[model samples]
Target: MMASQRGDVSAVRALFVSQRASPYDVTPSNCGPLRFAIESGSLELVQFLCHNGADVNTTFGTFETSPLEWAYKTRQIEIARFFLRQGARLDYLCFRGWTPVVLLFQESSPTVPLEFFGLLSGHSFSDFDVQDRFGVTALHRAARWGSVGDVHALLQLGASPTLTDNEQRWTAAFWAASANNVATLKRLTEGAPSNFIDHVDFRGWSILHVAIEAGGLETMCLVLELGVDPHQTIMVESEDSCVMEELTATEFARTKGQATYRCFTQALQLTGYNISVIEDSDTELVFWDT
Candidate 1:
């Protein structure tokens, strides 16, 4: 393990060849030399370990990830590709619904390379929409991180922007709004019509509502321009009962502060909305509508 972590390929080879060590030898943590080699970022050591019969699919660490996943998490694209070529499962979901495709977007820098997506796709099952345990697809991950290029690549690779995560059913637009990433949101809604920008999450929060809650004044204005009503409300349902709470966009803005409220009101006027109707105290609603 030490020699592998340090990229001492000859020592590793000698150990295996002299029968003094098993290529499968693992630490108390179940981590083998291949995992170390991947962490070391040495492709030569990785190749040597694999040639000497290291398990490409070995699951280790807290996430119980495969060697390919470690390579990805460590940003070793070449090593990851080598594992894929050695028959690592691209669709394999480790802890938290992480697959090679999801990892490529989630762990990669915003400066995504086209070749990375292409490589993963070539080895994948053509299911770009595969979600993790949390139901987060490649699109959701990319959009949440504001990686526009990754979003484009995933969409071109057949990933659906409408797919939601398991926890909140957050769509690509929803995730972008949650992160206050107007750039990603614009890219996502480029060809989308006005109605398409009105997409809501599991809580019934529209993109405008989410943007306001995210405290992005610019994004709020952008959504209004895209045609989301300023008076839009998000319905929150409690698990204990069937009762629902309607939280208006204005209310969300007000809670943010006087400045946010001013921005919200101004955005409404700029979009040609009747600001008075939204501000009417009689229209005020509580968390519990009962």
Candidate 2:
């Protein structure tokens, strides 16, 4: 395990040749030798382990993570592709019920290629929408952080935008909105019904409301242009007193600050709604001649 982690191909080979260690041996943390090789970020070391009977499909660790998942987690795109070519399972669920595809999007760097998704042709439409423990699907992950190309690829591969997470019952569209990904949100709802955009969460917070509070000015404008009700209200519970209050999207934006409030009102106005703008007296001081 130490040799593999250090990328010492010669020492690892010596261990194998001498029959002193098995390629399948796992550390106390349940990480197999293959995982250690992957952590070293050396394709040569990884290939050596696999050639010596390392189980590419074997899931170790508490999360039940596979070698393919490790490859993705480490940003080894070539290794991931190699694992795919070696027939690694794409739909296997790991920690927190995250599938290999879902975990790929969870990565924060090295944007995944659209061609990479093409390798996962064995899965059915339902397989792409497989949810995690929180009912968060690959589409939800893609919508949140993956590129527009990533979202499109998932959609083409049968991921549904309508699937909702367990906690907020937030659809992929909602995730897109909260992430301020206007392009992704637009693409996700391109041909969808008006009710889809206007659909509210468990707290009665619509996509418009989410855009107003968590999204940017452009996102808020886009939601309004998409026919989301500007006057829609949500019942929010206060964290301190647990007080439930119903507030419209505009009113909710006010709590976010003047800039957000102004953005929402301007969006409403552009969409031909009659929203009266309230002046902030605190922002202006009277100048009197003394």
Candidate 3:
């Protein structure tokens, strides 16, 4: 383990030959020697360990993270590809119920090459829309953090942007909007169903509502321009079950306080709403003229 962590191939080989250590030896924390080799970024050492009997698919840690997941987490694309070629399973769920594909997107740098996903083609798995335990898919992760090229590659590979997660039932477009990733949002919604942008979560919060709550002024304006109704209403249930309050997007923003209220008002104005602003000693008022 020490030699592998240091990436000393000669010392590791010597230990193996002298029967001093085995490739399957793991740390007290359940991390294997191959994990150290991969973290050391020594592909040669990794190849040697695997060739000498280290299991390429060996999982370590409480999450049951596979060797391929380690490579992806460490941004070792070549090592990851090697593991995949060695029959690394993409379907293995980690502690978070995240598959290898979701991990790839979640852990990879934003600059990861588009070709990175192309390697999955050699693998037998085709369900790119598979979700994690949280019901978040690879596409959702990509939309939040990946480059446009990454999203394009996933789409080509069969990841569905329309799929929603378990918590919020938010599709990739909603995730992109919440992250203020307008470009990714546009790319995801392109050629989508007519009602795609109009989708509301379980709470009846639209993409515009999500943008406002996330403090993304630009995203709010973009969604409005994209045709989300600014005056769309959602029913908010009060503590009294018999009393329900109807709130519009602008009204929802008001409850978030002054800064958010100002932002939403500006977004409405920018999108061509004839809003009149009035200031009083105690409160600010806005009137939308139809």
What's the TM-score of each model vs. the native?
0.81, 0.86, 0.91
Per-residue lDDT of candidate 1, residues 114-185 (tens digit): 777777766655877877767878788788783777777777787777777778767888888878777788
Worst 10 residues of 3 by lDDT: 107-116
Highest TM-score, which number? 3
Number of the top lDDT candidate:
3
Screening candidate 3 with a backbone cut-off below 3 angstroms (N, C-alpha, C), the clashing residue pairs are none
Clashes of each: 4, 0, 0
Worst 10 contiguous positions by lDDT, candidate 2: 281-290
Better of 2 and 3 by TM-score: 3
Task: Give per-residue CA lDDT, model 3, range 1-290, as digits (tens).
Answer: 88999999999999999999989888888988899999999999999999999988889987878898788777788898888878788777678777666766663366566555666666666768878788999899989887777787888888888899999999998888888888788788777898886789998988888888877788888888889888788877654566789987777787777898899999888989899989878877778887
Name the TM-score of candidate 3.
0.91
Candidate 3 residue spans exceeding 4 A from truth: 235-245
